[model samples]
Target: MEFLLYKVHGSMNTFFMLEGEEREDYEEMTLKLAALDPGIDGLLVVLPSQVADAKMRVINRDGSEASMCGNGLRCVARYVCERDGVEEAVIETMKASLHVKKEQPQGDGIAMYAVEISPVSFQMADLPMAYGGETEWKLKPLPFVSEEIPFTAVAVPNPHLIGIVPDEYQSNPAHQQKWAEFFNGPNEYFTDGVNVSYATKVEGGIFVKTFERGVGFTNACGTAMTASALVSCLAGLVPYGEVAVYNPGGMVKCSVEKNGSSFRLRLTGNATYLAKQQFKWEGTSSESGLELAEELQEQALYEKFIEQTSAVTNRFVS
Candidate 1:
C-alpha cells in the first residue's frame, strides 16, 4: 500500500520513479500509477538490492512495457543519485545494466547525469526479428510497409526499425501517426514485435517520432534514439559516434561504435524529481482522465510542498 514516488525531467521527456515496496508488483503498479497520474508519460521501477532477483520494469503511461528505455534510465539514475547522495550507482532494468553517475550541479539548479546502456545486438537470436537472421542489414526500401525507405535495423537492448523521413513529413502529425499505426498494427511481418521511427535532420540534430511496441507513440524513447543515430550514420545522414536525438518527450545524446558485425549504443541524459505523497482511494474507481486529475490535485499541496522541497531545474540546448 506504501510507495515512494520520484519525478525527473530529462532533456526531452519526464519520468516517474517508483520504489520502496517489496511486495508491490511493480508491473501492476505501473499501470495503476499511470491511471492515477495520466500526466506522467513514462514510469521506472527500481527494485531493492534485497530483491535483486526481481526484474525492474519500465512502463509507458499508456500501460505498455518497453524492453528498454534510454532517456528513462538517465532520469531514474539522477533520481537515485540525488536521493542516495552517491556520485555513481547501478540500477538494473528489464534488459540491461544502467550505469549512472551524477556530475557537479549547474548554476541553473540542473544536475547532469550520465548513463551507459549495455550494447547493441544484431543476432537473430538477439534482435529476434523474423526477417533475414541479422547479417548487418540497413533499412532499405521495403514493400511490406509499401514505402521505399532507407532504414536501419539494430538491437540496442531492444529491436527497432529506424527510418529517415523527408522534412515535410517530419513536422506533420498525421503522417507520423500513419507510420506509427503501420509498425504497431496487426501484421505478420513484425509478428514477434518492432518499434518504428520516422526521423528528420534539422539544424542542430535529428527529430524523431517513434511508434513503440507494447506502448504506442510516446513522447520519447531511448532505444529508438540509439537506433535513429546509428541508422543516420550508416546511411550517411550523420556522422558516427555522438549524435543528438530529438523525440516528442525530449532530446537524448546517443553514441555508437562498430562492434564486430553490429554496433553499440550508449544514451546519456537527466531525470528529474517530482513530489511524493500517499494516496487513499475510496469507493469504486473510475478510469476517466478528469477523475485521475482530481485525485492527483487533492494530494498536491502546491505552495506548501514547494516550500518544503527544493526545485530541480531543467536545462536544454533549445
Candidate 2:
C-alpha cells in the first residue's frame, strides 16, 4: 500500500516514514524494511490525528513501538505544516501537547519549527518506572567508569535520565558505553524504559549525546534535549532561559521556564525536505488483479495520510 515516507535523521539516524495503519506482523515488517535498502533506518507508526491531536506511536527498526520522539516530532511538525500549508499547530503525542510554530528559514533550504515540549516531572509515578513505587520524587546517581554522575529522572512527554558529564567522560567511549549498559541494566529502576543523556558544558552551549530507549546512540533527541535542559537548570548547569543543545545532527535551541514544580521546554530546529515520489508495491500472486487492488488500497492510504495532515494544517492556518 502507499505510505508516507521520509528519511529522518538527527537524534538517531533512522530512515523512517509514517504508516496509516498497524502492520499485520509488525516484527517481520520491521526486519523487512531494515533490509529493504541500506538507508532504511527504522519505521514509525503515527496517528496523524492522534499525535496532532494527542499522541503518536513510535515503531522502531526492531518492530518495537515506543511512546515519543524528540527529533521525530520536529520533523512531523514541519511535515504537517508544509504539506498542509499551515503556520501554527498543536500536536498531541502519547505524552503531552506539542505546540509547534513555523520559524524563519535556515541555510539548508529546510524549514524550521519550534515545538514546545511538556514539563519535567521527577515523580516516579509520572515516569511510571516499573520497579519503583509511585513516590513524590525519584533521583539517582550512576557511576560511569570512575566518574559518578548525579542525575534526575524527568519526563518531557517521554521518560529520561539527564546527567552532566565532566570532561573526562566526554571523549571516553568506554564511559559512554558503561553509561548505556547501566541504563539498560535492571538496577536503573525505570519500569517503563528510559532514554539517557550525557551533557558536557561548552563555551557557548552544551554538547549532548543520547541513548534513546527504542533507538540507541542518536545524534539528538528533542524530548531528551528538553529534559536535559531542565535537568541542567535544576543542577545549575545552565540558566533558566534559552538553552542551545549541540547534537550530531545539528544544533537546536530550547527555552525553559519553571511551572510550579515542573518546567516547560520549547525546542527549535530545521526540517529538511527530501524527494517526493510515488511508492508502488508488487506482490507475486496468481491474482495479478488482486495485486492491482492492493496497489489501489496503498495509494488510497497515502492519499488519506496527505488529506488528514492537510486538514490539520488547514485548521491552524484558517
Candidate 3:
C-alpha cells in the first residue's frame, strides 16, 4: 500500500506522520520508523475519526501508545486543514476530543494553530498516583527524584508531574541528568510513571525541559509546557493568563485560566510541515518489510523551517 510520510514539528518535538490504513502492526512500524530518526519523539498514525474530523494515535518511540499528545494534535490539525480546505477541526484522541483552528501564519509555510486542552484535573486519582489525601497535591517533595524538589501533579487529560526549579537549573546538565534518571529509573511513587517537567521563570515567561514517559527526553513537550504554566499560576509565580513558554525546540504561547475550581488551557504554536515522502508497506508482521523511496528527504523545506524559527526567536540552535 502507498503511505505519505510527513515529518512535522510542533515546538521542536518531531513526529513522523504515516497517513494510511490502521494496520495491526502499527506498533511495530512506529518502533522501526522512530528508530530511524534520533530527533523524532514519536510516530503518529492518522486515521478517520468516528466522532471528529480526524483521529490521531500517538505511538511513542518505545512502542507504547499515549492517550493524547498536544503537539501531535496541532500537526494533525494542519494536515487536515490543508486536505479539507477548512480552518477548524475537531480531532479525536484517545483521551478527549480536541478542537483545533488554524491561526495566523507564524512564518513562511509555518502556520500557527491553537488547540483547546481541557478536562483539567489535579486529583491524585486522576494522575493515578498511589499517594495523596483529599486535598490536591502541590509543592510536595517526592523521593523518586529529589527529596528537596517539590512537584505538582496535574492531568490536562494527560498525566504530568511538574517541578518548578531555579532559573540556573533550567538548562543545567546536572538537573537534566537527574530528570533523565527519575523518569527512566525504577521509581515507586509514579507507579505507572508520569511525564516530568522542570521549569524556570524567565523574563517574558517560563522555560521548561521535559522527560516524557515512554519517550525519554524530547526537544519539547506541548502538554508539559501547558502543565508547567498552570503550575506557575497556581504557585503564584505568574498570574492566570497567557504565558510564553520557551523550550529547547522553540516557543509556544499558553493561556491558562481558572474556571470555578478547575483550570482550562489553550496552546498556540507553529505546526510546521518539514517534508513528505512515499513509503511502501510490504507485509503484516513485525519483520514485515517496508521500503522508503530514495527521494524521501525534503531538505529545502526543512532548512526553511529551521531558518524561520531561528530568525523569529533569535535563539541560537546548535
Candidate 4:
C-alpha cells in the first residue's frame, strides 16, 4: 500500500518522517529510507500514542534505535500537531514525554517549534560512561584526547560527550572525528558508544559540532547541542542564561535553568518541511519505492533565514 511521508529537518539534521505503528523491521527500513539522495541522518517513525499526542521513534541510518532525538522530535511534533489540528502537544520519546509547541514562524514558509529536552543528569551511571569510577564526569581532563581539553558527559537522555576545546580543534573536523569514532567504537570510556561533540565559545554564543553515535558527523544533533549549552554554562564558558548555538547546519537558541538538582533545557529552532512523498510499503525495505509528490520549498526559506541569523558568520564545518 502507498503511504505518505515527509522530508523534514531541524537545523539540517534531516529525516524522512512517516506515520506507522510498532514494527520489528523498522531498523532495517530506516537504513533504506535514510539512504535517499542527499542522505538523511535517520528516519522518524511517528506512531500513535495513548499517553500523548504522538510517539516518536528515531532509527539511525546504521539501524540503531536512539533513546531520544531532539531534532527528530521537533519534526514529529510539527507533523502530528498539524495532522491532529493542535497548537501544542506532548511527544512520547523512549526516555521521556516531552512538551512541544508551535511558535511564530522564523521566516516565510519556515515553521518554528520549541521542545523541552530534559530529565537531565550528570551522574556517570546515567550515561554509564566508565571514567575512574567517578559519580559525575564534568570538566575533567580525559588523557586520551588531551589534558588541555576537558570533557563533560551529560545524558539529556542521550549520552553526549562534550569537550570544551580550543578554537583550532573545534574547527578541525579531523581532530573531532578521530575522538568521536574512538569513543563510539569499542572504546574504554563508552562501550555502547556515545554522541561526541567538540564545542568552542564564540562571540555571542558557542559553536558546536557533533559526531552522533549511530550516524557519524551529522550537520547537527539536537540533543548534543542542547547538552553543549548546558555543559558550557556549567563550565563557566557562557553565562547561565540564553545562548545561541551555531552548528554546521544552522543555529538554535538554547536556554538551561537549574531546576532543583537536575537541569532543564529548552531548544527552539526551525522545523522546516522540505517535501512530501508517497511510497509503496509492502513490508520490505527493498520493495518500497518512494515517489516524489511535492516540494514544499521550506528548505530554501530556512536557508534564507539562517543567513539572516547573527551567528551564521561563525558557522563552520562539522
Candidate 5:
C-alpha cells in the first residue's frame, strides 16, 4: 500500500503524520518508522472523528500510546488545515477534544498555529500518582534531590512534574545529565513514570528541558512547557499572561489563564512542515518494514525555519 509520510516539527520535537484509516498492524508500523535514522519522537495517525474535524492517535517511538501531545497536535492542525482548506479545526485526542486555529505566518514561509489545552488539574489521582491520604497536593522538594528543589505536579491533560531550577543550572551540561538520570531512575512517588521538566525563569518567560516518560530528552515538550509556565505563575515567578517559553529546539509562546483556583493554557508556535515522501508498506506485522521511494527534500526549508525562528526568539528575549 502507498502511504504519504509528512515529517513535521513543532519547537524541534519532530513527528511523522500519516493520514487515512489505520491498518490492523499500524501500531507496529508506527514503532518501526519512528525508530528510523535521525529519529522521530512519535507518530501521529490521523483518522476521521465523529466528534471533531479529525482524530489523532499519538504513538510514541516505544509503541506506547499517549493521552495527548501538544507539539503533535499543532502539526496535525496544520496538516488538516492545508488538506481541508480550512483555517481552524477541532482535534480529538485520546484525552480531550481541543480547538486549533491557524494564525498568521511567523515570517514568509513559517506557519503558526495555536491550540487550546485545557481540563487542567493538580490532583494526585489525576496524575494517578501514588500518594498517601492528602486532601491537596502542592509544590514540594523531591525526596531524591540533594538540595531543596521544589516541584509542582500539573496535568495539562498530560502528567508533568515540574521543577524550577536556577537559570545557570539550565545551561550546565552536567546538571542536565544528572537531571535526566533522576527522571528515568526509580522513584517512589511516580511508579507509572511521569514526564519531568526543569524550568528556570528568564527575562521574558521561562526556559525548560524535559525528560519525557516514553520519549526521553526531546528538543522540546509542549505540555511540559505549559506546565512550567503554570508552575512559574503559581510560584509568583511570572504573572498570568503571555509567557515566552524557550527550549533547546526553539521558542514558543504560552498564554496562561487563572480564575479563582482554576487554570487554562494556550500554546502558540510554528507547525513546520519539513518533508513529504511516498513509502511502500509491505506487511501488517511488526517485522514488516517500509521501503522509502523518495528522499526528503525540504532540509533547507526546515533549517531556514529553525534559523529564522531562533533569531526572532533571541532578539526578543535577549
Candidate 6:
C-alpha cells in the first residue's frame, strides 16, 4: 500500500510522520525509515484514536517505543490539526492525553504549536530507576555521572535525568557518551535507561545537551529540553517562568509554572515540514519503498531564523 509521509521537525528534532494505522513491522520499519534520512531521530506513526484527535506512537531510530515525545508531539499536533482543519486538538500519548494547540504564526513558514507536558513526577519509582525507594531524586549527589554535579530525575511522562553544570564544569561528548551508555545499556541504576541532559546557564537563557535513551546525541530532544527547563527552575538556576532553551540543533521556549509541590510545563516551538514522500511497505526484512514526492523550503528558512537569533552563539555545552 502507498501512503503519503511527512518529514517534520520540532526544534530540529527531525522525524518522519505517516498518516495511517501502525504496521506489525513498525520496529523494523523504524530502523529502515530512519536510515533514509541521516537527520531523522525517530518515526512518528499516526494512528486513529477514540479519545483524541490522533494517537502518536514514537519509534526511535533504535526501534524502541517512547512513552511520550515532546518534540514529536508538536509535529504530530501540527499534522493532525492541519489535516482536520482545526486550531486545537488533543493527542493521546502512551502516558497521557496531552493537549496541543496551534499558536500564532512565528513567520518564515514555521508552524508553531504549544504542547502541554504534564503528569510530572520526581519519584524514582515513576522513572523506575533502581534507586532503592520512591524518593524524589532532587539536587543530590550522583557519583556515577559526576560526583561534583548534582542530578535530578524527572518524569514528564518520559524519564529524564538532568544535571545543571557551570560553564567550566561542562563535559565533552566522549565523557557524556561514557556515562549515558552505562545507564542505558545494563547498569545498576537505570535498568530501562533514561534520557540524560546537562544544562548550562547563559546570559539570559539556558543551553541543554542531551543523550536520549534510544537516540544518541541528537541535535535536540524535546522532552529533555522540557525536563531541563523544569529542573533549571526548581534549582533556581533560572526564574520560574518563561525560559529560552538553546541546544545544538536550535532553540525552544518553555513556560514553567509552579503547581503546589510540582510544576506544569508548556513547550512552544517550530514544527517545520521538510518534505513529503510516498512509501510502500512489504515485509520486515525488505526495504521500505520510499520516493520523494515533494520538498519544502521551510527548513532553509528555519535555519535562517536560527542564524538571526542569539541562541546559536550562546551554546556553551559542546
- Model 3 lDDT-worst window of ten: 309-318
Write one digit per residue (lDDT tens) for candidate 6, span 73-186: 999999999999999999999989999999987755677999999779988888878775647788887865678787899899889999888765444566667888888998
Question: What is the C-alpha local distance difference test score of each model?
Answer: 0.62, 0.61, 0.78, 0.85, 0.78, 0.85
Q: Tell me each candidate's RMSD, in Å, in order.
A: 6.6, 9.9, 3.2, 1.7, 3.2, 1.8
Question: Candidates' TM-scores?
Answer: 0.78, 0.77, 0.87, 0.95, 0.88, 0.95
Candidate 3 residue-wise lDDT, 245-297, digit = tens:
87777788999988888777999988877766665555443543335534433
Write down the worst ten-residue block by lDDT for model 6: 309-318
**Candidate 5: how many backbone clashes?**
0
What does candidate 4's lDDT look like per residue over 1-318, in tens digits?
A: 776878889999998888987889888777667665547888899998889888999989888989998888889888888998998999999988999999888767579889999778888888879878788888888886788988999899999999998778865678888888888888677878999998888888888889999999888899999999999998898987788998888889888887567687999888888889996766654677789669987777888877765354454652
Off by over 4 Å in 5: 22-24, 173-187, 284-318
Worst 10 residues of 4 by lDDT: 309-318
Model 2 residue runs over 4 Å out of place are 10-13, 22-28, 37-41, 46-55, 130-140, 143-147, 185-188, 276-318
Candidate structures ordered by lDDT, highest first: 4, 6, 5, 3, 1, 2
Ranking by TM-score: 4, 6, 5, 3, 1, 2
lDDT of 1 by residue, 1-318 (tens): 344466555544556666654443445555666666666666777666543222356777666677777777776676667668777887777666667777554324445566666667655456655555446556675555547567666777777777777765655557556755765667644555777788877655677777777666666677787778877877777788888766655555688777667566677654545455543323224432112111233122222322321111111111
Error of 4 at 295 (Å): 0.9
How displaced is residue 248 in candidate 1, in Å?
3.0
lDDT of 3 at 23: 70
Candidate 1 segments exceeding 4 Å error: 21-24, 50-55, 104-107, 132-136, 259-262, 280-318
TM-score of 6: 0.95
**Model 1 worst lDDT window (10 residues):** 309-318
lDDT for predicted candidate 3 compared with the true structure: 0.78
The worst-scoring run of ten residues by lDDT in candidate 5 lies at: 309-318
